[model samples]
Target: MVDRESDTYSCECAMFEHMGILCRHALKVMVHVGVCRIPSHYILKRWSRDARDVLPDHLKCYQKDSD
Candidate 1:
Protein backbone atom coordinates (compact mmCIF):
# COMPACT_ATOMS: atom_id res chain seq x y z
CA MET A 1 0.00 0.00 0.00
CA VAL A 2 1.11 3.55 -0.68
CA ASP A 3 2.05 5.67 2.27
CA ARG A 4 0.11 8.93 2.12
CA GLU A 5 2.53 10.72 4.42
CA SER A 6 5.64 9.50 2.61
CA ASP A 7 4.18 9.33 -0.89
CA THR A 8 2.98 12.11 -3.16
CA TYR A 9 -0.64 10.98 -2.86
CA SER A 10 -3.21 13.48 -1.76
CA CYS A 11 -6.60 12.59 -0.25
CA GLU A 12 -8.60 15.50 -1.63
CA CYS A 13 -10.97 14.39 -4.40
CA ALA A 14 -12.12 17.90 -5.17
CA MET A 15 -8.52 18.87 -5.74
CA PHE A 16 -8.02 15.83 -7.95
CA GLU A 17 -11.29 16.41 -9.83
CA HIS A 18 -10.44 20.02 -10.48
CA MET A 19 -6.90 19.10 -11.44
CA GLY A 20 -7.59 15.78 -13.22
CA ILE A 21 -4.88 14.16 -11.13
CA LEU A 22 -4.77 11.53 -8.43
CA CYS A 23 -5.13 12.71 -4.87
CA ARG A 24 -2.85 11.36 -2.16
CA HIS A 25 -5.41 8.72 -1.26
CA ALA A 26 -5.77 7.65 -4.87
CA LEU A 27 -2.00 7.47 -5.12
CA LYS A 28 -1.97 5.20 -2.12
CA VAL A 29 -4.50 2.97 -3.86
CA MET A 30 -2.39 2.99 -6.98
CA VAL A 31 0.64 2.01 -4.91
CA HIS A 32 -1.37 -0.80 -3.37
CA VAL A 33 -2.09 -1.92 -6.92
CA GLY A 34 1.69 -2.32 -7.34
CA VAL A 35 2.49 0.75 -9.36
CA CYS A 36 6.10 1.32 -8.32
CA ARG A 37 6.61 4.24 -10.63
CA ILE A 38 4.38 7.26 -10.58
CA PRO A 39 3.32 8.46 -14.00
CA SER A 40 3.45 12.09 -15.11
CA HIS A 41 -0.32 12.29 -15.33
CA TYR A 42 -0.77 11.31 -11.68
CA ILE A 43 1.14 14.25 -10.27
CA LEU A 44 -0.44 17.60 -9.47
CA LYS A 45 1.35 20.94 -9.24
CA ARG A 46 4.41 22.57 -10.86
CA TRP A 47 7.09 20.12 -9.85
CA SER A 48 5.76 17.24 -11.93
CA ARG A 49 6.67 16.42 -15.51
CA ASP A 50 3.56 18.18 -16.78
CA ALA A 51 4.94 21.37 -15.28
CA ARG A 52 8.52 20.71 -16.26
CA ASP A 53 8.42 23.18 -19.14
CA VAL A 54 6.52 25.75 -17.15
CA LEU A 55 8.48 25.57 -13.93
CA PRO A 56 11.79 27.30 -13.53
CA ASP A 57 15.05 25.39 -13.65
CA HIS A 58 16.91 25.15 -10.37
CA LEU A 59 19.75 23.03 -9.10
CA LYS A 60 18.97 20.55 -6.37
CA CYS A 61 20.43 21.61 -3.05
CA TYR A 62 21.18 18.01 -2.16
CA GLN A 63 23.14 17.42 -5.35
CA LYS A 64 26.80 18.37 -5.60
CA ASP A 65 28.17 19.50 -8.94
CA SER A 66 31.17 17.54 -10.23
CA ASP A 67 34.30 19.41 -11.07
Candidate 2:
Protein backbone atom coordinates (compact mmCIF):
# COMPACT_ATOMS: atom_id res chain seq x y z
CA MET A 1 0.00 0.00 0.00
CA VAL A 2 1.14 3.56 -0.70
CA ASP A 3 1.22 5.52 2.54
CA ARG A 4 1.57 9.14 1.57
CA GLU A 5 1.50 10.51 5.09
CA SER A 6 4.33 8.30 6.34
CA ASP A 7 5.94 8.07 2.93
CA THR A 8 6.19 4.34 3.32
CA TYR A 9 5.19 2.49 0.20
CA SER A 10 5.09 -1.26 0.39
CA CYS A 11 3.64 -4.45 -1.02
CA GLU A 12 3.36 -7.93 0.50
CA CYS A 13 6.07 -9.13 -1.91
CA ALA A 14 8.73 -7.06 -0.08
CA MET A 15 10.76 -6.53 -3.26
CA PHE A 16 11.52 -2.89 -2.43
CA GLU A 17 13.51 -3.83 0.67
CA HIS A 18 15.56 -6.46 -1.12
CA MET A 19 16.10 -4.64 -4.41
CA GLY A 20 16.00 -1.00 -3.20
CA ILE A 21 13.50 -0.02 -5.87
CA LEU A 22 9.76 0.36 -5.92
CA CYS A 23 7.83 -2.65 -7.12
CA ARG A 24 5.36 -2.54 -10.01
CA HIS A 25 2.41 -2.49 -7.63
CA ALA A 26 3.74 0.47 -5.66
CA LEU A 27 4.65 2.28 -8.88
CA LYS A 28 1.16 1.72 -10.26
CA VAL A 29 -0.36 3.13 -7.10
CA MET A 30 1.86 6.18 -7.28
CA VAL A 31 0.84 6.78 -10.88
CA HIS A 32 -2.81 6.19 -10.18
CA VAL A 33 -2.75 8.53 -7.19
CA GLY A 34 -0.97 11.22 -9.21
CA VAL A 35 2.23 11.34 -7.18
CA CYS A 36 4.37 13.76 -9.21
CA ARG A 37 7.62 13.24 -7.34
CA ILE A 38 9.18 10.30 -5.62
CA PRO A 39 10.20 10.85 -2.01
CA SER A 40 13.95 11.25 -1.34
CA HIS A 41 13.96 8.60 1.39
CA TYR A 42 12.85 5.98 -1.08
CA ILE A 43 15.62 6.89 -3.51
CA LEU A 44 18.95 5.10 -3.32
CA LYS A 45 22.04 7.22 -3.89
CA ARG A 46 23.90 4.47 -5.74
CA TRP A 47 21.08 4.16 -8.24
CA SER A 48 20.97 7.89 -8.83
CA ARG A 49 22.81 9.70 -11.67
CA ASP A 50 25.29 11.25 -9.19
CA ALA A 51 26.12 7.97 -7.47
CA ARG A 52 29.84 8.58 -7.85
CA ASP A 53 29.72 12.14 -6.48
CA VAL A 54 30.14 10.95 -2.89
CA LEU A 55 32.99 8.56 -3.65
CA PRO A 56 36.54 9.27 -2.38
CA ASP A 57 39.43 9.65 -4.87
CA HIS A 58 41.19 6.49 -3.72
CA LEU A 59 38.00 4.47 -3.86
CA LYS A 60 37.52 5.66 -7.44
CA CYS A 61 41.13 4.52 -8.24
CA TYR A 62 42.07 7.84 -9.87
CA GLN A 63 45.66 7.72 -8.51
CA LYS A 64 48.42 6.24 -10.67
CA ASP A 65 50.20 3.04 -9.54
CA SER A 66 53.77 3.48 -8.26
CA ASP A 67 56.39 1.59 -10.26
Candidate 3:
Protein backbone atom coordinates (compact mmCIF):
# COMPACT_ATOMS: atom_id res chain seq x y z
CA MET A 1 0.00 0.00 0.00
CA VAL A 2 1.06 3.55 -0.68
CA ASP A 3 -0.05 6.69 1.05
CA ARG A 4 0.35 9.59 -1.34
CA GLU A 5 -0.13 12.24 1.36
CA SER A 6 2.50 10.78 3.66
CA ASP A 7 4.73 9.46 0.85
CA THR A 8 5.00 6.12 2.53
CA TYR A 9 4.87 2.64 1.00
CA SER A 10 4.24 -0.74 2.55
CA CYS A 11 4.45 -4.29 1.20
CA GLU A 12 3.54 -7.64 2.63
CA CYS A 13 6.79 -9.19 1.32
CA ALA A 14 8.98 -7.21 3.77
CA MET A 15 11.85 -7.45 1.25
CA PHE A 16 13.00 -3.90 1.81
CA GLU A 17 13.14 -4.21 5.57
CA HIS A 18 14.91 -7.56 5.53
CA MET A 19 17.12 -7.30 2.43
CA GLY A 20 17.53 -3.54 2.09
CA ILE A 21 16.15 -3.61 -1.46
CA LEU A 22 12.74 -2.57 -2.62
CA CYS A 23 10.52 -5.35 -3.87
CA ARG A 24 8.41 -5.38 -7.01
CA HIS A 25 5.33 -4.45 -5.04
CA ALA A 26 6.89 -1.26 -3.75
CA LEU A 27 8.28 -0.39 -7.17
CA LYS A 28 4.83 -0.79 -8.66
CA VAL A 29 3.39 1.45 -6.00
CA MET A 30 5.96 4.10 -6.74
CA VAL A 31 5.25 3.90 -10.45
CA HIS A 32 1.53 4.05 -9.94
CA VAL A 33 1.96 7.10 -7.73
CA GLY A 34 4.08 8.80 -10.42
CA VAL A 35 7.25 8.87 -8.37
CA CYS A 36 9.91 9.81 -10.87
CA ARG A 37 12.85 9.34 -8.59
CA ILE A 38 13.58 6.90 -5.84
CA PRO A 39 13.35 8.43 -2.42
CA SER A 40 16.72 8.74 -0.63
CA HIS A 41 15.51 6.71 2.30
CA TYR A 42 14.97 3.71 0.03
CA ILE A 43 18.53 3.78 -1.26
CA LEU A 44 20.80 1.75 0.99
CA LYS A 45 24.32 3.10 1.45
CA ARG A 46 25.82 -0.39 1.62
CA TRP A 47 24.45 -1.22 -1.83
CA SER A 48 25.96 1.83 -3.53
CA ARG A 49 29.09 1.69 -5.69
CA ASP A 50 30.99 3.92 -3.26
CA ALA A 51 29.79 2.06 -0.24
CA ARG A 52 33.31 0.78 0.61
CA ASP A 53 35.28 3.89 -0.27
CA VAL A 54 36.65 3.97 3.28
CA LEU A 55 37.84 0.73 4.76
CA PRO A 56 39.09 -0.16 8.22
CA ASP A 57 42.85 -0.72 8.60
CA HIS A 58 42.40 -4.42 9.26
CA LEU A 59 40.09 -4.97 6.29
CA LYS A 60 42.28 -2.95 3.91
CA CYS A 61 44.47 -5.97 3.21
CA TYR A 62 41.55 -7.79 1.58
CA GLN A 63 40.93 -4.98 -0.89
CA LYS A 64 42.71 -5.02 -4.25
CA ASP A 65 44.63 -1.77 -4.77
CA SER A 66 43.03 0.31 -7.53
CA ASP A 67 46.35 1.25 -9.00
Report the candidate with higher TM-score, 1 versus 2: 2
Write down the TM-score of every candidate: 0.38, 0.71, 0.75
lDDT of each: 0.58, 0.80, 0.84
Q: Which pairs of residues have clashing backbones in candidate 3? A: none
* Residue runs of model 1 more than 4 Å from their true location after superposition: 1-12, 19-21, 49-67
lDDT of 1 by residue, 1-67 (tens): 3454565455645566676756667766776778788865555566554454443346333334412
Give the candidate number with the greatest TM-score. 3
Model 1 CA lDDT for position 24: 67
Model 3: lowest-lDDT 10 consecutive positions? 58-67
lDDT of 1 at 23: 63
Give the 10-residue window scoring lowest on summed lDDT in candidate 1.
58-67
Task: Output the TM-score of candidate 2.
Answer: 0.71
Q: Of 2 and 3, which scores higher on lDDT?
A: 3
Give the Å error, residue 60, model 1.
19
lDDT, candidate 2, at 54: 70
Candidate 2 lDDT over residue span 1-67, tens digit each = 7667897788998888999988889888888888898878889988987776676866766534412
